[model samples]
Target chain A: MNRFAGPDGNIETEIQKSLLNIDGGIMNILSTVIRKTILTVSFVSLLPVITLTVSAQELNALVWCDHADDKLLKPFEEMHNVKVNIKTYEGTGAALSIIEQSAPGDWDVLVVDAPDAPTVAGLGLLEPYDASTLPMSDLFPQLTEAPFNYLDGKRYTIPEKFGYYGVAYNKDKVDPEDMKTAEVMWNPKYKGRVAVYDYYFPTMQLVAISMGISPDNITADDLEEIRKRLLEMKPNIKMVGDIVSVQNALVNGDVDIILNAAEFVVSGLMPTLPSLDWNIFEEGGLMWIQGLSIFKDSKNKDLALEFVKYVVSPEGQSRLATSECYWAMPANSTTQLSDAEREILRWDEQPGYLARSVPSTISRPEIDAKMLDIWTEFLQK
Target chain B: MAKESKSLKPLHIDYTRWAFHPALWFTICFFIFPLAVMLAISFWQRVYGRLSATWDVANYVKFFGSDYLIDSLTNSIEVTVLTTVISILLAYPLAYILAFKVPKRIQGILLLVAVMPFWTAYVVRSYSWLLVISENGILNVFLKGIGLIDQPLEMAYGQGATVLGFVHFFTMLITLTIYANLVQIKSSYWKAAADLGAGPVRIFFRVTLPLSVPGIVVGAFISFVIAIGDYITPQILGGGTDILIPQAIMLQISRAANFPMASVMAVTLMAVVVLVYAISAKHMKMERV
Candidate 1:
């Protein structure tokens, strides 16, 4: 009767058995699908919470390009079991803009030009930290009492890295003797062969130093003279640009000399490009120091302070000194840099260089504006 | 049938009216609001690096008074106009071939090949150009190999290089726009001109060229607007030999946090673009093709 019958010859029984089997198979498939859908939906629903938990452990920093190095930050992240989010800005103005646009507690740390640190502190954006807590003894003595690191007799930021705004040149193309004097900036022989680093402050300061005017002593009246001196070098200046552009000019042989640049511009390239070298002029070098500070409204203040501590440590200093972005002298005197690395940074010459250099300062607002105006004229010339 | 049509008219009108709401909202939220804010900010002042709502036009006064600053505006206009003229000159012939000469079956592929470089990053393309034209770059190396010159040419950096960079990018953009306009022209128009005892050259000059004015004007306007506002191309290739308005604007914002002054420059730039639009409005057939 029924071909689907098992062993018994009952047609109704065989038919019922076959129907049950079909229903069971459909139920199994439905259960599996429902289970998978439920699991997936549950997982997706918890994603935001999971993300919140992970982000809560992150430390946000607004810094210069140097602090973005993975080699400098990875150890700190691994040690603290936290994520570090960095936003690199070109200038103090940009960093301030970022802070102004963000909500309170959004940023945990800041790295600023040392001369601007006090101004930033005056704005009530930074929290004061004890000098005793920092590794002050291990740092160069001159960096410890930096006037810009303090405001109203309280320390607001600590110097993390320091370098000079001087000269970098291709030794093969230029006479090494000519680089020792600031006169090389305006030397007619090198006309259209010099690239000036396009930073108004230190470059103007260098011009002031060449004119035998100290940067700290610069007044509003001195800008015209400084502007004149700056324009005198226009003949020699093939280009004026930022670190990367000036570096490109040098590497491409577009220019033979770079003004307002030192080891920070060419030190990293020296090992591969032995022809490149940097030195300060006899007039004196203008020192540029970058400072680290904690934000006043940081939710993760403790973690932020710990990161500062890690950055100023010897190991961190070494990594930072050889950072991918640029190589410069670390604030900490006792960095663990290799012998070859030390040679590139001119470690042994730091004492003499530091003695000759006065830290670059932020001028009064009027003077700063005047400097920018004159610098613009120099560029447009 | 008339009753049914009348009944559907109100529904159709209602649907069309509601459809524009999203675009209106977007314009208000993104364009009108920010522009209003910028206009307001232009009258403010930066007092010791802090934004002050003094509601004065001193920033504008200062910009107009400074010769160096005014030079930046002039430089921008000069560079942008030169670049736009050069780009249109280069793009038109390429677009004409694509629209009239290339076979319809492979036009799409050919157009893709023509604009393929547009897919790359702008900054990368700029730097690549620098590497090719720099003193010791590829061009010099090749010239040296061929013993064409004893010294490397001073080709990179300056207004010429800046124009070159802009032309390289905008040429492709303009070609696409011109091609679009060219293809939409009825073939019957060209055929009609030929049938009227006109030669190919005469027909092209009288009919095809005249019809392509809308595309050229539209492209030129876009090129003018973008080139004038751009900071990177001029900054990278111009080599600080001169300063453009955008670079001058950036200097204020980046170095001084002088948003009031930056806003002044931006408003001035916007005014120039609007003036250009007014000048070219007759031929800008934006809705066509």
Candidate 2:
């Protein structure tokens, strides 16, 4: 301090200090800009990844059209912030084939008819549902203990809806008194005037029931007899179709009667036609129950179970039942449905109607893989 | 003699020629690889609800064993043969008219009319025939109004309806092929034949028919292949009585989930089509020579 203490020394020391300060400031500003840029780039890159992760967490489900209402799933979706994807199938077999092909976690939840649940479960496609986890008490008592969903007391499916499958005819062309039974559909009088479903199982079952053979004990021999009956009915049949074409035929008077049709078809057509009627045969008709199932390989098991719980909930069942104009019989025993709503759904406890509504006595025959081939061959011939 | 010659140098191999070629490997990966995989799948076995790699001939054996399958194959052949013959017979006259009789100004319009159906969906065209032939259809109403019959003829879902549908759909292609050949045929050749004292039929057979053979051959081949593979038309029109190969394959895959069996049927059908095409190609070559 004594030796370098001069006017020039003071100025030099001050200039060095200022230069150091500027250098430090420039470095700090450059580093901050670089860090911000990196953070912005990283956030942009992570946008799709984050979105995919969220979406993957959502349960993916495929169901038949008109099976469930979309709004019923809003609460479940919102609760877990998970999306629910519902794809509809035209027919049970069509839905089954898709599930079979895309097996092993392809779908989380499936809406299979009760008849198909055992078959699908037998194929090792369905996972055992945890009853304790869901509100099992809210389901309809009949479905809660239905044989279709229970295999050795383990429920693979939750029964969702029940309906009757039989003849749906135009009231104008076919008198209600004359159409007391499904036998009139095959009468020679309606030759080339009637419509029937082309599917083998339903058509064959209807013919079997009409012939006084319980559909439950159908075998290959029974199929042969049924085939002969079908051949007999073929000349009188104008067209074989599903609900849409059948309804169209009924409304347009293209066909007088439709064989092996569901009551919902008649219900839907009643508003427009108002003259259409449904008939349950004396031998009884096919009582179908459709249910919900979870795939064995579902990644979002919790979400799927939660969604199933919501579907079987009283509110959800009512929503589905009201919207689809069909019965969403809960599997739970305790869930209460109002008398007005039950009346609207035509849930009268009539002994005659209930007795007639017994599920088709037709045994779910072990479908021979070769049967379709054989049938196609016979039909083609 | 001592001068070096750059023009006489041999060309070098250009290894980098395909450096920028995008479709070179893309086409192979997408088309060829999938075809190879399909071929491989056709040879695999299905056992106990699981697919195994054990190669077997069971699928092929099963396909050949079924009378339904054989019937479908036979039906496909019969339909194709009928469609080809009918299309040729109908197309030749129209082609002759367009080339030798119609004015040049109307040829474009005529050709456009022939090709107009191609713009529509094949299914729509097939189903439209239903409305034309059904009991409550327009054709029935008109026929009944004119007192042609006491009852509406059940024309839909029958062999006759199927053949008619095929003829309606495929005749246009045949006409276009024949017409293209007809336009190319020189008028000078026909005039020369006439000048040499040949009659109309003789000139047509000697020059016109022989020259139009290539077009006829091409059209017939295309029509035959298309008709053979067609399942939708036969399904819509052939009634429950008629079965086709595609339908059999569809039944196997869709209803039975027997993909191996379906693959076998598909491969067999492909083989049959290829064999038929080879025979036709040979015949065409001989005719050309």
What i-RMS does every model get?
1.1, 3.6
Residue A172's lDDT in candidate 1: 99
The local lDDT score (0 to 100) that residue B90 gets in candidate 2 is: 92
Task: List RMSD in Å for every model shown.
Answer: 6.0, 11.0
lDDT of 1 by residue, A295-340 (tens): 9999999899899989889998999888888899999988888889
Model 1 RMSD to the real structure? 6.0
The number of the candidate with the highest lDDT is 1
Q: Residue B65: error of model 1 in Å?
A: 3.4
Alpha-carbon deviation at A221 in model 1, angstroms: 0.9
What does candidate 1's lDDT look like per residue over B1-289, in tens digits? 9998988885435767766799888999899999999999999988875788999889899999999999999999999999999999999999999998989999999889878878988788888889999999999999998999899998887889999999999998899989989999988887788889899889889988888899999889998999999988888988986889999988887777788889999999999999999999998874433
Scored by CA lDDT, what does every candidate get? 0.89, 0.71
